[model samples]
Target: MRFIRTRTAKATAATLVTVPLALGGLAAQSHAQDASPSPSGTFGPGCSALAQKANTAKDKVVEAAAAYPQLSHLVSATVRAKLSGALDGKPNVTIFAPNDQAFQQASASQLASLLSNQGQLKKVLTYHIVAKQITPDALAKGSFTTVEGGKLTTSGSGTEFKVNGKAKIVCGNIKAANATIYVIDAVLRPPS
Candidate 1:
């Protein structure tokens, strides 16, 4: 009886230890799979600042962009260029919108010049847009034609990408009613 009890206790202890070890291994494996990048949904560091809301997805491109404070400069520029009507009418598009800091990066004179000339402002602004909605995967090694009729290339893996080999996409995969917006760190210029 004593021997049987000793063996039973030993077996129970071993089972307890083994079960947790096995479960822990399984938990670790599951966590690793979760850590892998997901192709769907928004990406990039700047995405953290974005307020995730269902209403944003329902709003039109111009209206959706207006909700984000960081995109105020872009919205203002688009309105000033009289592009709100045209952009709102588009069924699908990809906009590499520059943040306020990007505009500040340009010389005051350059910004003044661009903003003052409607034709030039329209050209420069249109260059930042593509006629189709682009996904993060497509952005990896892409050469797309801009709305301005200029060609721009994007390259990089995962969440990092650049436009025209210059402007880095600060935040990507943002959805609007008729557009996918990738907020870039610099303004893109069309080929003259």
Candidate 2:
């Protein structure tokens, strides 16, 4: 899918790259904008944390998720969506995985219907991922492209981040061979 760069994305990219050099060769400090807070505390709600222990740099997204019981539901969804291989690649990826509790909150009929439609399921599942390797600082606030060709917005800093102002990150920065995983509390729906 082609990515349509949003205005917010452009602004963020400019900020990320425009580190102006100063007399001391350090990036100039400005009072108008603030940097992201230092990383600390738990990344999310912590249904079962993988950040503290997950360091499977040789495993793909699917392989990594399969190793954690807390991520079992997400693994099943990815499998059903036929997106397991899609998440394994050279491109850096970030997945906002929703825990089992998030899935349990959904209606039975909705999930059943989604699973039956391969295309729809793929779209929904891909919306939970970003095409870039987003770090905690970058997730402070910005718009980004998803593998499903959707626009995702994030806000907050440190351990208090939210996706599209809806889903809260439960456990973040879990390393996979090809992707970074951030477990969220709610499932993110794609735009119709």
Candidate 3:
């Protein structure tokens, strides 16, 4: 009986020690997960230029884009498309904004024709936006529907990403009051 008691006590003692150690490992893992950094702030190569040119984190999407001189043409196009209110009013969104250089990439007549038609202009502009704010991590291998209801796919990892397998994200993960802006090197067109 004493031997049985001793064996039972040893088992109980081993369980006590083992249980706490197992729990401690789980606690450490939980803490590590809790401590892992969430995606935040801005990223990409053009961020340096953006830092030198503007700080629009506190402004609304339209106004934030306006703050960057590189985005002047995009801002103008957004206003002309009558999308300023829509973009500014969104609680959360992702804007794949094309810089002025991207606008210049289009033929003069093509740009003029699109601008002259409000419906087409709005469709083109909205094609650059996603309803949900997307992070750089998600931007890698992302397939999202745009506000224009056309699908856009993103590829590449780290700071380099492309839209529709073409437009390179120049400056990405930029924060605004209502949106996150990723400045792209080319305008994205919606599917007809």
Candidate 4:
């Protein structure tokens, strides 16, 4: 009788230990499943197709920078570094990407001065971004507030949008899951 009782106690203790481990494993598995990427490779819901499109915009940015060595250096050193954190989540964002010519037109000394002041540089770049995706068609004769607490004006008859009343949208409608990127001919500036 003692032998049987000992074996029963051992079995109960084993179950007590194993059950929690099993439950823990299951809980971890559930978390992994919840965090798994969707079949389309996006992290979460809404605008998966748009997110796929944004990858193309990223590529285009790289390509444009490559084609323009000086501008590419600034993009890699300044713009890309700043945008890393802002692009990570599921909120809609619009990026106004300036081309090489725009950077070239800027006074090199002024550009250098801006780069020396990181806060000002970050604000300038973020000012070109909107917190929501905006289609080219939607950007007619209106202003959109930026992430940097400034407003960017848009004006055009059709398919020709401009930012800050000047920077023309050379390429538009590059979508991401929670964002859109518009390649522009000029960099935008905040009101002094």
Which structure among the candidates has the greatest lDDT?
Answer: 3
User: What is the Cα-based lDDT of residue 171 in candidate 2?
Assistant: 75
Compose the digit string of candidate 2's lDDT tens values, residues 1-192. Answer: 134567778888887666553432443455312444343322554734443335466788888888777678788988888788778864679888888778887899988888789998888998988988888778888799988898999888756789999888877777777888878888889998
TM accuracy, model 2: 0.73
Give per-candidate clash totals. Answer: 0, 2, 0, 4
User: Could you give the C-alpha RMSD of every candidate to the true structure, in order shown?
Assistant: 5.3, 17.9, 11.6, 14.9
Off by over 4 Å in 2: 1-42, 47-54
Top-TM-score candidate index: 1
| Cα-based lDDT for every prediction | 0.87, 0.77, 0.88, 0.63
Better of 1 and 3 by lDDT: 3
Considering summed lDDT, which 10 consecutive residues are worst modelled in model 3?
Answer: 32-41
Model 3 regions more than 4 Å off:
1-38, 51-54
Ranking by lDDT: 3, 1, 2, 4
Candidate ranking under TM-score, highest first, comes to: 1, 3, 2, 4
Candidate 2 minimal-lDDT segment of 10 residues: 32-41
